[model samples]
Target: MRARRALLGIGAAVAVTFTLTACTGSAAPNDGAAPSEPASASGPMTCETILRPSFAEQLAELGWSAQQSPFRIGEHELAEGIQCVWGDAEHATDVAQMYGWAPVSPEQTAELQQYLEDNGWLREEDGDVVYLTEDPDVVGYLEEGEYGMTYQFASGWVALADTKESLDLITWRG
Candidate 1:
């Protein structure tokens, strides 16, 4: 009689253990909550994503040097931005034309001058741009571009993005 009772007790314990396991492993309870949505990017897209079409990289592959780099040219910081190879003035003009960056206008030139001044860039002579910092990280220049008057950087260039949101899209994220 004691043996039979012991066997029943063991059976009851086993049943309880199996029930607990089933309850814990079931997904129905865990499915009640909605999943959180992934965050969307609001800033500059990665150079990797933009250049893969070869649209942005087309200039470099055409014997014009191009690589993606991120560096500080004075106050501004360039991260994962395209660094088009700089050559002689003729070569720069050819490349800029191909890229649709025509020369900027006089008014635009003033704007660029203001920007440089605001950013602590001092104008130097000899038709060359200069950064006045002891350890200058940026180059300064006045040039023309697709939008007319242009101020060029040693590592990057500023252009009026076609759409209002375009600037938001290209501006630094991190």
Candidate 2:
């Protein structure tokens, strides 16, 4: 019960912070990207089932192509919790990955933020998540418990823009 109360308090704080940041920040641009095809899952949502097909189509719309082979980090055979990548064909530039975990506590989230910040990732509040990225292009991660999302950009600013657009299209959807 105490832990639940603490989590509720933290969640309220996050909501207030997001509201203040959204009110202060410049309005995000309307990119006219299509909303992703609605994702459906029987069990826990995995990266492959939810992220790939929609993101592939979204990337194609943005003029990028998907690589055939995907790399993984964990021992698990399941691809999503491990990692998933999409990139160009010839040069192998412009890549993105999606994966996340639920922080055990607010302190863990803070430690994660500080670690990323120490590594030179600038932090910004987007909705309920604090996103970390560098300038000129938005390539970074937005972590909120079980919904953390990370991305990197190599193809340049256009790819970064498309990434943000696609994220906006799909982030809220189930």
Candidate 3:
């Protein structure tokens, strides 16, 4: 019985040592390797980041400011991304411009394209793609009445805006 107890104790000690080594071995904080951070940490996509400098200046000239908001297509809110509304800050109802940017999988892009087609949004001209030159593989769509536009980038980003000019002002690096 005493021999068995000694063996058990030895096994327990070995197990504890293995566990400690395993836990600490991979957790070296100062091994000269760069720390992992989210892609966005370097330059996050926000209302400011997405806008062209001239457009941002124009909005400022017009006394318009941007505020974060939820992005929606008709009544359906997108699950991820950043959306911004630009207008008079004091009057909440005076918001006349808005934009949104979201990353999309190829499948999601196809679904969005279908959704736009089904809802009667017109496909924009190939030349219109020049507006967002940062994304060479972008395609644009336009909706009348409300004057809304949507852009799908092959880089896996989708942008929505209330006006074509708003679309023109966007620059996405995704």
Candidate 4:
């Protein structure tokens, strides 16, 4: 019960944080880009069973492409080759803070980076620091603190984030 209350409190704090920022998904387009995601329906709401097919279709609708070989880290799968990119932030690095898109403290960034590293989602660098994945194209930009969010699509599995902050708070990582 206490744990549940704490969880609820954290969720409320996140909501308040965003409400104060008043940011939207209106940042610059991601890359040279492809067709934009449908305003009303970006794609579909997916889960473990429907992740792959739904994700592929969503990216396709949004202009992101996939490659044959996919990256597998633990239970999560990653796709490669970006068909197209679109977001307010240019590169993955600033997908969140470039504008009021999604604000994150430096401490949150460290917490998130460490979380990914402790888990299998990140790769070790020189035995100490860690990165999201092996692909250079797979950069980190959309970061969510504590229960952090990351966006790194290689080829197999990718989850689209509506906003930089949304990427951080994604319910599903793989």
Candidate 5:
């Protein structure tokens, strides 16, 4: 009886351990290799790959280099997506241009649009393109001061830019 009780206790402990491990979503050990990144809609968008060559050259002429950064809405940083900022080469302090792109499901796209609407971002249409901007007065052009713009593409990419021209620079291969 004592031996049977001990064996049952051990079995229960093993089962609990397994259950907890499964609940934690731990994957099989990869033998010290780095874990693989999640695949993007087309491919992972990097600061180098997403920009048009001409735009990249233009940025270079202005002494700006692209850096990977976080995408923020208000004060909250989005957990997913790729963000790029163009700034001075040495310090990266002058972040006058920035953009973010993420592939979204239809539901997520709708939720984002609703969020923008609820947040009082003004929506403006320019031919086939729709832009949501923080300033209603900003139509097609970005003036001297700062502004935020968001665009949703039919190809499952939702993008945000600090300026309209910055948004225009992205090539959106996704």
Candidate 6:
């Protein structure tokens, strides 16, 4: 009789365990919530390949050089994107900085343009690309397309000036 009770107890425990597990699992992960984008389901699209070489050549022409900074890239934490920086120790500055990802919507672009204009940045339209500049320093360019947009910024008057010139030359070549 005791053996039979022990077997029944074991069976009851197994049944109870499965019941609890099923009850807990009833709360499904995507029960009603919309699907979310995976952080890195796809690889990052980087402009570093296209712009880095141009920046290197431009910096060298302006008596500056591009050296990779040790600091963590994408410090902005803006979004899932690529961030690259080259330091010019001679000027104690970043000679070239670029971050690019999927293109922002037209509305977002307009909003950003308005903010920059308010802050003294002049905008110039170059085909699908928009160039933003300010006196003495500050040169930034935004190019939009089906793939995405790339925004590149260069500081220091001479560096900014030459970098634009280099961009014009390179882009014109193709």
Among these predictions, the greatest TM-score belongs to: 5
Residues 1-174, candidate 5: write the lDDT tens digits.
343334334334533554454456653221212125432344666765565444556567757787787655565455566688666777544334566766666776667666776787777665544566676353424334535455534435567765443454455535
Q: Please give the lDDT score at residue 25 for candidate 6.
A: 60
Q: Model 1: how large is the Cα RMSD against the reference? A: 29.0
C-alpha displacement of 62 in model 6, angstroms? 14
In model 3, the Cα lDDT at residue 33 comes to 21
Q: Compute each candidate's TM-score over C-alphas.
A: 0.24, 0.38, 0.55, 0.21, 0.57, 0.36
Flag regions of model 5 displaced more than 4 Å: 1-43, 75-80, 89-95, 125-129, 136-148
lDDT of 3 by residue, 1-174 (tens): 353334334334533544454466532221112236433555867777665544556566657789886655656566667788777576554334666777776787667666666666666544323112212122223212323344544446667665433454455534
- What are the lDDT figures for the candidates, one per model? 0.31, 0.36, 0.52, 0.32, 0.55, 0.34
Query: Which residue pairs collide in model 3, if any?
Result: none
lDDT of 4 by residue, 121-170 (tens): 54433332122532223333322332222333322223333223333332
lDDT score for candidate 2 against the true structure: 0.36
In model 2, which regions exceed 4 Å deviation?
1-46, 57-82, 88-105, 135-163, 169-174
Off by over 4 Å in 1: 1-49, 52-54, 71-73, 78-174
TM-score of 6: 0.36
Q: How many residue pairs clash in each candidate?
A: 13, 1, 0, 14, 0, 0
lDDT of 1 by residue, 1-174 (tens): 353334334334533544454467531111112115211143343432322123334333444443334433334443433323222253553222111111234654455556667775544332332222211234212112112112332222332222111121122212
Quickly count the clashes in candidate 6.
0
Error of 1 at 18 (Å): 66
The prediction achieving the highest lDDT against the true structure is 5
Candidate 2 residue 83 C-alpha distance from true site, Å: 2.7
Error of 1 at 61 (Å): 5.1
